[model samples]
Target: MTPGTRKSALLAGTILSLSMLAGVASAETTVTMWTFLDPNKTSPREVALKQMIADFEAANPDIKVKVEPQDFAQMPTKFFLGHQTGGNPDIVWIDAKNLSGLDTSGAGANLDELLINQWPQEDKDDYYAKASFDAAMFGGVHTALPLFNGGSMIYYRKDLLKEAGIDPASLTTWDAILEAAKKLTKDNDNDGRVDVWGFGMPLAPLKTESSPVYISLLEQPAALYTGECEIKLSSDLGVKGITYTADLITKHKVTPQDALVINVDDVTDQFIAGRYAISIGSMLRYSVIKGKAAFGADNFDIIKWPSWTGEKPGATPLSGWWVAAWKNSPHLPEAGKFLNYMLGKEGVGLWTTVGGQVPTRKSVLESPDFAGPQYDWVRLMVDAWGQTGYMDPPSCNTRTLQGALNEATARVVLDNLDPVEALKEAEAKFADAQ
Candidate 1:
């Protein structure tokens, strides 16, 4: 071949290569996500998320996800604050308690409009339940997708209940629970002191444990929300719930009196030490209790909250981090696609199998991956989500609400204040906080 022809062909090849690279770069889109978890971290959730992101990227080479880790408690507040400066993230992770505030902020995107409008009802029905989507729904629109599921339940000694001839199902009512507690409470050495308190509940306002317990075990606190940020917990129904909780420590003597000062951590310690038959706790603590229990790890299992009547189980506060997109994000379409990918059946299924989270999809929960004895806790939690009611977080100050309730409980059980009086004080404090 002639030198001139060879040189012309080489020049044309170089130009074509440069043009292709430019096309690829121009088509690529980057989506930024804000979360408390660093994908580089080795935690199970982080690891699973990291792998999921990598998988998404591999499947869609035109898009890249940029994760920006933020402090969890501050993420929600910071997200709104950033909106003021026009520097909001493309996507954000929000805690459930603060989710109501998201609607008023006007920064959250309408996920139903962006993603779910075209989805068939069969696909929509695949979600765990109405609450699964309702938690993210605001003013008749979905603003986010539930990323994980968490709820508090009573962790009990399986062996102790069997020895006492108490079927866990029989303790479905508070009255039945009280009777079972009476039987379970005993002194092993014939001492006049109880070696095992039938139940342990953390009532200290200084700790957040008791407040979660109070919310998880009943729906009244959420029911009292006036929709205008006012909570009338001083009402007759509210007073009744508080009275029952206090009587367990003050009158029935089934729960340890020391619960007034101890938190859930302390209660958990006492439980593992075999000084309590049942305690208010979380699934996150299940593995720890199982590994550390003095009596036997296999003896520990969970029970859903009992109701005032045996008609229904008390609501569990079933919420975890939620995934949302900025309403005015420049990359709204791309962000919506990423959110769908992250929350899709395969994605959440991978999360349950690898991240060790409770699956949020009914199909995933029933899948073969969840089979076997090791996943009994997962099944129990699935029932907790399916069979019982759930606590709805208020749009107002959740911490303040919890504080007021905790203080009211402390006053009744510790200072001997009247339940109505304490409830009134709580109502005033909560009103002032809002």
Candidate 2:
């Protein structure tokens, strides 16, 4: 070949090779995710999350996951504002209650097509119960996938129950629980004040931290909202439930009087200090209670929330964390791929193993790892799941509705106002917010 022709051919080959390298680089997509998971924390949840991201990137060499951990308290405001300005992340982990707020505003992507067209039927069937998945839908569109869930449980000192000659299982009804509490309350040192209360519950009018006891007592579905989608805080059942909760402090004198003003952390601190025989709150407290409570892990166990007569145990509603992709995410395909990866069996197992979360899939829940003596409480929680339900509140007014619920609870339980009157006032406030 002529020297000029050889040089031209070599130049064309180099140009083609460079063009191929550029195409390969452009094929790799970066999917940005925002979360409250702190990578710095060595907790199971945090470590597992970091590992999940690393594993996903390794498996999908063409996709990169950038997880930006944000301050937990500021996430809602940040996400909402980001959505408004088109600066939101491709994916986010949201609290279940908060999802409605983002979803109804059109910030969440409709995952129906993906669920139906992309996901295998076997994979879809792996969810613990269809309820968790069903709850993720809003307006018939799949808004998110269940990440983990927690419910209110009554953690008790097994030693205390034994000393009181009370079988924890027998306290399956509110009346029975109060009776047990009466027997369990004592002034051990003969001090004027009761040092050990039978039960501890948070009742402060801040956030919805104090709403669990009341919410636990109300009947399903109807307990959340009226048929018209208005707050049903003033309903007959609502009044009855809150009244019973107040009576536990005012009349029965079973729970600490200070419970009227305490929050979850305060009550939890006291619980770990061995100040109460029974405490009502989140299952997430299991880690601290088991790892740090003065009574030791062996002495601590949880009973399902008691139910009204004719109802099964754990009849209350359940709530938890969820994951979703943004509606306007630039990398929709990649976002969906990552979501499925994070929620798959290996991902769920890691979450349950490392984070101490209750598995949201039936197969995982029934797995031997989730059973046996070490997982006794998890087993009971599954039993409770059989009886509990989930009802999503209107997202637009979640903060307001939560505030209203707290205020009404304070008025009824702390101020000694009539339950019906307090709830009616809250219903009015809810209407105004709407």
Candidate 3:
């Protein structure tokens, strides 16, 4: 079938499945769920989520579910507007990066009461403790429940690395990465043009603002709010991380000079098209590369981010979609019931499979079903996340602060400004945002 035809068929199938199971809503129970993921991606995790929802509907005939999907970039504004109009979803999927902002705004329901009263102790125990803890205590109140979790992993084209004579296994530090990048980078065609870039990473402030690069590197406990309204990105460690990223382009010349101009989609496209040997971002790139780019799993591989000596090995920032009820949601009890169903064993398994996302449930992570090529790296990623991960802190003005850091990093890398000076300027701007 043509690509368009296949896409249409997939959509039709999803709609049919949802319709078949959406039984009549009880007068008191209508659970509305809004998320930032597109439903048509056909990622394993997404497919499983659909199935889980259908199963939930089948079992709970009295509670109807309404799903509204939005793009990631548009979610923040929509969430705020929903808060203002008190028309938000009963369950909303939020990124960890936005937790601080949500906490400050008091837009979400505190899940503590629900957890204590509704969730089984075993079910609560099944979740990764840190994720569960983080979700439960935003500003000392349980604000959300972990849905899907993921962390960054280094993505490389093995064929390209072999041609460059670089041992992928030996890449354990930024210096080694730079050396490999140099070898992989070359004018493949003799037409006075470089055919492949050694590395490609998002650097545009506007684009990388939400990309999770800096958060991964700094390993700060929280970037925006310290729960008491203090900004922490102006620290020495933060400066070091920012400088290291800048050096990839300015000093090492490993990445594309115009990397700052590219967004996440552009970087992913270039990597899939074999325009770069290495790309750094979420491990879910495996699913995208496999399904969307039509590449086999064996064609690419992943590694943890290279380490910085004397300090703990840094991994990419950990973040994911979380389920939370809006403070004004009328269907609280049903929303709570749907949440329990979604996080249950079957739901967890289906969501992890279809979404191509890691399960937040420790039971699911350790289950025999999770053992496979597609999920092996998830284990490694989870281990690394536990060791080196940092969550965004609760801040009264998180988005603004994040924007400032993005601008500071961009100026240093793209505009060739001094790193220290740029960061100092960023710190000042961050302070002003308060």
Candidate 4:
């Protein structure tokens, strides 16, 4: 054969190989995920999540993740309904309150069968939030992997505490914090209106399902719900939690009256604007709050929830978001790979450093990355999750429960109803939901 003929044959072979490679790439599986966060956005958490997905794609050339951002409050209802109608995405983000119907409806697949979820006992034990994982399980099968496991705690100004000579340790109980708030509330310019209030927390469920402050207090936590899934908000602890939240507005005046209509995000903004010396905020707000703290991010740190009875630390609701697979997705395995990658060591590690989340991994939280004063709040939260935290029992009707509890707070704070009577009304409303 001629040398020119041999060259043409080699070129043909290379062209065929390129075509086959492109075909293989085109056949890659796409795993669709429904979450509240838009990875395309510029927020820190969103940017981190986007980076995580990019890294996962780089690692696994055969799988692709398509993130569908939804309103977080709408995820549960939309997902459950989608499951019923065969229109759900391959994966979904399940918040704590909506975990009840997951297993029963088979909307969430048994994640235990996933290879990544079958971690070694040591790897499993390394996860700090065990209850979070347990909360995702139903009927002896794991339904989801707990991705962002965190709870509410007090974010306070270190500078304010030091200036007022208020020892941080002494503010261990709710009552003590109230006293400190009163001392901190002052008008530096001698005006009738106070400039810097002592505390700020959002009690209105006007925007969302319920108030996180009220949840941490009333659910104060597992004790609030009885055997029949009936919430006993009228209990002593419940009444106490209720009265404490209301009195802060009406009696103590540490928190502004306008707080009655705002949500946690609104109050976080107020605290960042330097309106409050201390505020009740979710652990998820750590990075955002840290960035905007007028007193300096390092000067701002979270403390453990002040104990109600002072016997133990207050309840940290086993709250936060979860990543679960759809039972009917044709791409279930690929979905698990994406979910596991996002929740694994590298991904979960980024949650602390990049996303500002209190991840479920202990080693990630305890690492050198999380060391020092800025991350001390992370330690306090870890302690609470490991020791005193509790999640509410699974209930199909959490929206109603939250709505009822919100009315209870609104009536007490706005209408001046007795705390006991307010809570009794809350229980009655919760019962009506059943």
Candidate 5:
């Protein structure tokens, strides 16, 4: 062949080789995820997720994960808008409270079938029988898989309790709790200002922190909601529950004058500053309590909520982040694999140890590390989880219902509105939502 012909043949071979390499590159699957966990931050959750992602890629070399972290408050709206506009991610981290609403809005791909069709029975056994698996199902359709389960606990200063001549062990009823609170409340420096309030109650207009506590106070809070999702916040029992809690601020004056404006963060900050003897919040606060507050397990501790006479103490309902695949995701298979990896033994192990989440699996929870001294407080949480009561009304409009409850609670505590009147307003709003 002539020189020109040989040069043309070489160019054609080069083109063919380049096309083959491009095909190989395109064969790799990419799964996009949207989450509130900021990978740039060195928080435990972020670190665990990064580790999980690295492990996932190592195991599945053909798949790649792309994480897009956004603000936690903005997630629900952004996910809803993305679903509406057809520009959604492959996977989303859903707030447990919003799972039903998002599932109803077509954001979640039905994962119930995966339990039967895709997942092996042995693999499924690792998850909690009802709390982890069934809790994710909305109307029998599995909307998501729990990233981890968490609930609030009341944290008390054991040192303060002893100083006030109150025994925490003897306080298992509302009456005893109130009496202890009275003792705990005092003006330490003789400045005529109450430096330490007995209890820190969250009553902010936007935060529904009081809702869980109020529910725990009820014998059966679910009785406040009908089968048709009609809220009966003005029921006699409901009134009594709200009245007793509101009295902590109004009648008893154990909480601050502006407790009506305090949210979870405010209460936590105050608790750390030694301004409150007792406060309620999530298990995530344990890190702060142990590290920043410099409080030993003896100085501070958590307990199940006090109950009415002859009733069992109640625990907060399951509340945490859940992961779900979007129905519109083009990479469903890859997304499913990623989710499975995150929920598997290795993923959950890293999360519990590093991410500081309560275990969703009984077996994992029973592990020796969880029973170790470092995580002894988790035993109380596990006990609480076992006895947790359901507070959320099963409705797609739960946010509306919760907002109504929050508004009514604020009115009763701040404006001194009658419990019946405040709750009637809340009932009207919930009925309107339905």
Candidate 6:
């Protein structure tokens, strides 16, 4: 079965099982949660989260929080299936891109009334406007609360750029990046083969949905659809983005010719090993790789992705998970209390520091403690958030459309297919699928 189908089945089973357990919770109120992050990791977030849950349990002696870790890749399908089956968890993590799908599925509970009635105006104003707005409405109903806000940035090796004699400050456009890449690409072993690549990107089909290639190419002012039922990849901006990606491999030869097969982990590995000078990734990516990668923090620095038309460079798309309560959840009041606590000052601060994720709250962003060397990129990201776009297409059949897009990209870059013909065929397939 496809991954989506398998997730749907798992969620259906979970819902049925939970329904039977619901009746036995009279003595203790248990709030079930589904999340993508693995708590077993040695990251600060993992440690803090465990402590947070323990503290929550201590404070709310009558309630217990039971977490069910799920595969991130299957979260959307499982969430929809559980909602349809009346077995959704009290709280779950949801990707921003799936807002439209959740709204159409009628799976999420409207939280606007709760927010207005319960939260203070000061608390409401703390959140970033865009993050708050995206979570507030799904199919015209407020459904979820923003958790962590994130945006993409360019992570480059400073030493490598200096060695190439390229001024990092001047590398603000696609043309400049290509020129730097040429200078950076080198073979130190005196072999004919080039050992170092100019750039690294996550091109593996496994991570195609959240890959940087898509963000670099398709996410822009005119490329994304804000509605729940439109596809806008045929626009001039979209084409420009795609052509630029093709050019990186075919025209400029900066990125590896086989990049389409390299996953994010592999890309990170290469960057750490000094195989590439530059990479595109989310802000949290640096934190995640800090101790794990060979390169120390001093070796790399973050910047905005290069612009195309001489306009100021824009950051990549801003997106992250949100927390939502199921409409039928018995512990609605308790869940709301926990959510509020999570969004409060202490909770947001702990979560942000541990997870290396930007806070949704403006107050947290403005905190004196948060204004540190670690958050410089985050500030730049927020400043450029308006220029970024969410990564979802409006059509319900997005998976099929995405598959066609990936295939078209692979054909043009790897198979030597004509770009014009490949794009035309891909568009035709997308239109037919929709």
Top candidate when judged by TM-score against the true structure: 4
lDDT of each: 0.78, 0.76, 0.70, 0.79, 0.74, 0.69
lDDT of 6 by residue, 282-387 (tens): 5656666665556676777777767775476643665567777777777888777777677677778878777666777788889898778878766767766755
Which segments of candidate 2 are over 4 A away from where they belong?
Answer: 1-29, 114-116, 210-213, 393-403
lDDT of 1 by residue, 309-406 (tens): 66767766676778899998999998888888888887897677767778777788888878878788888787777776464554566566656677
Instruction: Give all candidate RMSDs, comma-separated.
Output: 4.9, 4.3, 10.1, 3.7, 3.1, 10.8
Lowest lDDT 10-residue stretch of candidate 4: 207-216
Off by over 4 Å in 3: 1-29, 38-41, 129-132, 209-243, 310-312, 400-403, 413-415
Residue-level lDDT of model 5, residues 387-406, one tens digit each, is 75453543536656656766
Q: Write the per-residue lDDT of candidate 3 for residues 1-434, one digit (tens) a residue.
A: 99999999999999987776663223436688887554454666566667777788899877777778878777756786789888778888777667665676678787877654476787667777475446536656778877777655678887888877888878877667778888887787778777887878866555443333354336545543444656556566666777767777788777776777776677777877778888875565566776655345567777766764525555556666677778778788888888878767777777766666677788988888888766777786777777776554444445555456667778987687876777778767867766
The lDDT, on a scale of 0 to 1, for candidate 1 is 0.78
The whole-model C-alpha lDDT of candidate 4 against the native structure comes to 0.79
Q: Is candidate 3 or candidate 5 better by lDDT?
A: 5
- Tally clashes: model 1: 0
Extract clashing residue pairs from model 6: 126-362
Error of 1 at 354 (Å): 2.2
Across 172-221, the per-residue lDDT of candidate 4 in tens digits comes to 78888999999888788997998998988766654442343354455345
Clashing pairs in 1: none
Q: Which ranking of candidates, highest lDDT first?
A: 4, 1, 2, 5, 3, 6
TM for candidate 2 is: 0.85
Residue 343 shift from truth in candidate 6, angstroms: 2.3
Q: Is candidate 1 or candidate 2 better by TM-score?
A: 2
lDDT minimum window of 10 residues, candidate 5: 208-217
**Candidate 1, poorest ten consecutive residues by summed lDDT:** 208-217
Q: How many clashes (backbone N, Cα, C below 3 Å) per candidate? A: 0, 2, 11, 0, 0, 1
lDDT of 6: 0.69
